[model samples]
Target chain A: MTTQQEFTDYQIDALKELANIGMGRAGAKLSQVFEHRVTLNVPNVAMVDEDKFNSLALKFETGSPIVNIIQQSFIGEIEGRSAFIIGGHNFADLVNILGYEEYDAIDEGHQKEMLMDISNAVNSACLSGLAEQLELDIELTNPSIAAFNTPNSALKDFFFKQKHQETHQTLLFEIKFFIKDINLYCDNIISLKISSLENLRNALERLL
Target chain B: MVNEEQFTEFSKLLQELSSIGFIILDRRMNVIFWNRFMELHSHIKSEEILSRKLTSFFPDVNEAWLNKKIRSTLVLNNQAVTSWEHRPYLLKLPSTQYSIDDVDFMYQNCSYFPVKDSDNSTIAVGIAIYDVTEIAVSQKLLENVTEQALDLQEISTHDHLTGLFNRKFFLDQLVQDASRCRRLNWGLGIAMIDADHFKSINDTYGHQTGDDVLKELAERLQATLRTFDSLCRYGGEEFALILPNTTEQQTRQVCERLRECVDKAPIISAGREIPVTVSIGISFLSRNKSLEEIISEADAALYLAKHNGRNRVEQHQAE
Candidate 1:
């Protein structure tokens, strides 16, 4: 695992630039799907240990009436996972924009499937954009709902149980997208396996 | 990347074997691939559907919205998803499932996916359709059952003969209304009414005439009270009225109206016109008064109305 000291300012800047490009594409695609202008802004990226992921997950703990998470894993030159989390109220807002009647006929399972479709859209767009820009190829598995909670308090324990080996660092990106007109909000998180960090760094070097 | 022939072969296989409906549209929204499931559901084979605009076949589809969804998949390279809850059905295909007969059209959840070539440019967009009629039908049935249960509960709380609140329900309401009146410092009045000479009328005429007299008396008593008042069949030839937010003078006036209403009308049953009269005993709610105490006062007042004279109104005199 590489420390923060090993990566120069230029390498971090390059990675941030890649996030901007990829997230920009994701934001645009999201805007089209919802028929509303969506804005995505990521201020910083953190490289930390796997244990810290539990803490990083706190921001996504909206404590809403319902919480749904969709996580998809990708493998190729760089291997990692992307998760999309949305609060129930925000999801209801999204459902309204999608032209669904309020609480009419959708069950929990169908709601999860609908959310997974949206997750697949954003994850594939962002990852594909990053891959295309870095000239690397990554194949993604089918998106699936990873977690569902009504009270949202159980989400922290859910993340804590997914601890990995002690040898790797996790690259965590906390990003949010907004559909301002409808007052809709959602969070997207991308975490890369520590073993893939070197390969990602090598790809960044090749681009530089 | 697969060659053109290989891709075409794959598309044909997808059209042939998949149970779910699948359709592929080019940038112009022209149908390039229509699968077997689509043919079986939509009744349009690929030979006729190929190279045709999707809108021509299903004009009910919101063109502007569909164009935006397809544009996102084609240009932005992301999938667009919609469920049956939103639009119900995209193609308006008839429901083929035997489990659900009430629904005329199939419920669909559609996902539009981008198809890319070697250069990574999106050449076409594919829609994956899933039938969700079972879920929709089940939810509908559950709501219907809840409604039926509510109707049954109403039947259980009402009297079959007079179509008024039953004795048990009135007693339950008495406790709740009495407590509310005490807390809010509002006046509550209870009146016990009995049909005068009801037994002699049954013997002189018949039990059917007696039933008619009771039914007419209940209707007149209900009509004399306000909509918020509670009317219940207390027992044989006896009925009760619970009035909230009423004073002693108001209760007397209402009781007088009830007596006049029954005395003025003659209930006709089986070609016989029989006069009907009611004696009413009234009592008002007071501070620290229990439900049993209020009922006893009303019953004593009713006895006084019978003793003083038949077919009259009497108020409980607190001693």
Candidate 2:
């Protein structure tokens, strides 16, 4: 029987390569939209349990008290969720980047729309990148805001609160994006189900 | 070749007949189609706008950002939307004839999607603009009404001259605070403050100057009290202060400080300095006592301060 660590190491390198290709395209799209230089760090792909999902967030420390997270679930060839998190402190900077500062008050619906747009871009680019590489047809839903103005404690339980069908390991892809010109920072996390992991591996092997 | 002209004629009819703003742009961001609604509101004819970049005329439009929205639709085949809240007007169009007052520009909700060809390849991006002026006007009206209601509430509850709680509101708060303190088993402090010789001040100086002195005295008393303390105008140059969770000693000390605050400083009105002083009477709350009993206790102390001499702090004598 192959241990989890062995499987993780074996898949991490390939997944990293796929992530670079995927996030590179996402970054390009973001750069074009923001009219700023957006740089994405090398994505870290690892297999983690549900408990580890909360632990992983501890590695990132933001000065802001509240973390604004945009979450979207995708169900298709694979089932999983994607989240885009930004510090509350940087929300003003984001508004300026989107050229939405002219409005006196931005309504809740409008704020959700703006965040959903960003989520859609990243989720679509990342999911499609993995789908194309594995040659799997995936159906992505319209991006919806799962949580906003989340505290540290609530954000920790975000993953556990999702609808549980069966226990499956998650292939967690973590990437950081920086807009150097505006000093804006955002993190994108994509988690895939472990059962789907086997299907993805088999699909990649057939392509090989 | 024949289908091209037919498509053009169909588009022309759609543009002219539709009330919504419709415009189609190619990959290069060049205008491919501009509907009659756009022409009427923007006052830019199709002849002049054709083949021209939309952002060229509307310099405020974020061309690069808008292109990204178009690209997302083109690449992912998803619809992109912008509301009036996010971006009020993509194109600054004239307001509707029946728009609410103070609304000069049209409010718009815009949608962008990819226009596909026969091969299912996206050739151009289509933008549909909906005039949401009535919804926007109604929202503004609601906000204004809410603000006006809050303003009216403030005017009703506060003394206009001193900006402190009026007699009716002060009495209500006193009754509520006294009952709460009894239930919680905490001491409540009550102090009655009156400006010494205020009638004479108004008689010597004009009423305008008298109003200024009252305002200044209210400011001084507010500064001397803690954040949790409540001060109110108790009618005719007299004020009531309620301090919760305070002992008799603390109440006396607070009243002393308030008396000193008014006595040491002279209020300047109309560029002339006038001497001013106040007498403060302090009382502590007792269980099972009514609000009037507590107030009458403080009122007796205030009377003692006036009798002994003005500009002093006095505690209620034990019966």
Candidate 3:
């Protein structure tokens, strides 16, 4: 749990358990928020290096589908960011969910705003669920679109933003949410500050 | 040197007097504080807005979404920023920008900050709104100007009546294509077409009817040509065609199709059907032939077509 030490398997497993329980509540919240049936994926928890992060991103974006990313930082006992990546394929259906009567190209400004609103809801619910389990007081900052109508190449830029954090390694949580009826899906990348995450070593020991 | 209470009063005075919009709301988003600028722009006095929910005055707001943003700011204990690019404005106050257009709503950049009580629990939220309508309007004007400039540039190169490339553009394009064809050892076809008895028709029916007939003939020539063919309004009563990668045989076949179309049907002008036929001159790009020589060859063949019969097609044969 130390800044220099890598995450042990037990910690990763404990975090995965924490994520699944949190996402269960988040999926229900999302279903109500979007008025669509939401399905959650079994969360993937890993400590990633630069090379592993790129390959991991490529695995999620097969055929390099265009995507938009909205990211927000969480503060308090748990510090880091969550980037919710909405795929391009989901846009036509997402327009209806956002209450747009007809999708016009000029409505790009409004479309991005609604997308940010949706992702902000998603990030807050997931992070609060994890923070509550850790007994960590957290505050999520405003969400912003990190990239729009772009390739997943921005995924690298998302990772590098954590360079300012005082941690040698990065803890990443990958969660995929699906609205099957609308054929809409969003992949989430949640990275918590390593130092803040390691602070839970004592609590995780007893909990695990 | 102000005391603590005096300093609080002084800050309160400053907040009310500040130019930017400032509002304070309790947990339910009811207006707790409304500054002078908010009153002036919103037309709602502080006394009127206070204790009222923010959405009551601005009914267009999505209250459900606004509540979600406020709750996140409270739990996260952070200020959330909204840009004009994303939502334009949260509260649609009237714009202050001076313009020829009608009065439009103001574009705003807003922020939401959580206020905590003595016990450290979030008690209220503060919002700050900045007017950015002038910036938004200027950006929109720039986009429109750029589009108009592109349209003007396109108009300069096309014939107004036929919507085809003008004679100047045709001459420039032919020179380039002719040189490229010779360098690549490919053949380029050049054909000149003219409506027979165009002047007599203009004299009898009037210039307007002549225009209608010319436009009709241009449409027929365009339809009979291949996708790669480039048609131009070469003169007052004349049209030209440039066919890429075409040989002598292909050129003759294309000329026949263009000629047959106008010869087959009478051109209908203003619902009046008038019989019409065209004469065409066909020539192909050859080795060691200058562009001027090729053009002159086509012109001479056109004269021959007029001499043979007014409504026939003719090929330019090398001496």
Candidate 4:
């Protein structure tokens, strides 16, 4: 029986591998649509305690730091929260590559539709792979997005609360993928309570 | 552990769990089972719909089409799906609630799955109906908005009189092309063209004839240019062309060709053939020059062309 602390490492590695496959597939699909060669990098995985999560996120900052976030809840034998963060620099490059004429005023409704499209593609690719690998049937909720020039204030507060809570464990993974001239950077964090560790271990064990 | 009462309870729970209107039909299209969803969506209750042929109650079910789909699904043992794109059939189910003014409801998606028996023979068909009227209506609204936006953009960027890029879009392109030329180390050229004595033409002939002459000139210019060249209505009785990656000599040659083409064709307007000519000024982008400076140089060349002789091309030589 794997303990909660040990299961964090296993989940990090498993998520990294799953993200690699999913990103590779998404990159291939994007390249076909854009008619350009694409490259995707295997993600860096980390298990961060709540105390270190806030400071750790602050270390990675550049330019305007446009962040696209998607949150989903998975419920089966082992339930957890899944979040994806995409950098704004990558989004600007994508808009240019897709040949959208730069407008003086960006339509909010159009921007929301575009966010939904990108979130749907990336989230579905990554989460479906994770589900298949874990041998679990997971239901996906409608995706919601939050953006900020700086690190998300709510996420920072969430990390602070996690540190105060009895369970101070979270798995964070960062992945960088490129399509032609555009580079896409994503961060995924899977957070779960210690009580769910046994079910998570069983889910991972069935995969092997 | 399998009891008849327990099976009945499980069946009741399964029916209640479904959001879609579920109706089980026999081979003759007689309703066998009508769940609560169907009862709520369609005013017909289980007692009224059961043991009655669908056409006898609804009178809209095309027997030929329904029987064909049922026979196909039974033969293949596969589920048959109907989407709104094909609009297989419209289900007019009455609203159970009397508070709602509209009694009839529109169901967009329907599926028929063949129910088989132990002997592998088709016993019944399960029909699943989904209400997608809201989705269909919303999609149409979105399409309408997109189309209106595209139309408005097109109107804003184009000249209404002569179907060419207006002055605003032309200037925007000039700025972009100038910057691209500077970055790529390529030459960019602009030509300022004006109809010679256009006021005199309108004075001699009517303004209507002068308008015809302008329209005719626009057609000739469009026909004489290459695909890479863009011609815009710079202003009244004047037009501009932006040529990317063109040398100064090539620019002069193109302007001369356009001038000659215009001179040879006499514009026919109001049953009178009127002769017209244009003076063109050409200038090339320089490393030390701004877009405004280059345009001013072309304007000076145009002044020189008008001062000397009309119906000719003049190259801007920095004084």
Per TM-score, the best of the predicted structures is 3
- Backbone clash pairs for candidate 4 read none
lDDT of each: 0.78, 0.78, 0.78, 0.67
User: Mind sharing the TM-score for model 4?
Assistant: 0.36
Which docking category, incorrect, acceptable, medium or high, applies to candidate 2? Answer: incorrect
Error of 2 at A80 (Å): 5.1
Determine which window of 10 residues in candidate 1 chain B has minimal summed lDDT. B78-87
lDDT of candidate 1 over B1-319, digit per residue (tens): 7788998797778979557889989978899989998998899999998999999999988675567567667756765667665457878899877766678889887878888877888899999998888887787789999999988977587887888888888998888888888889899999999999899999999888888777777787888889989999999998988998898898899889889988886888888788888899999888867778989999999999999988999888988
Candidate 2, after superposition: displacement of residue A11 in Å? 6.3
A135-189 in candidate 1: lDDT tens per residue?
7888777676777655576566556654454444667667776677876677777
The weakest ten consecutive residues by lDDT in model 4 chain A span A96-105
TM-score of each: 0.54, 0.56, 0.57, 0.36
Q: After superposition, how far is residue B204 of candidate 1 from its true place, in Å?
A: 82
The candidate maximizing DockQ is: 3
lDDT of 4 by residue, A19-102 (tens): 577557655654543445655444465556755687755643322335656565556655566555556445455444333334
Clashing pairs in 3: A139-B76
lDDT of 3 by residue, A41-160 (tens): 545888776677777677663233677888888887767888788875565676555444355223788668767766776777787677667666788888888888887676677667
DockQ, each predicted model: 0.10, 0.11, 0.13, 0.01
Model 3 chain B poorest 10 in a row by lDDT: B71-80
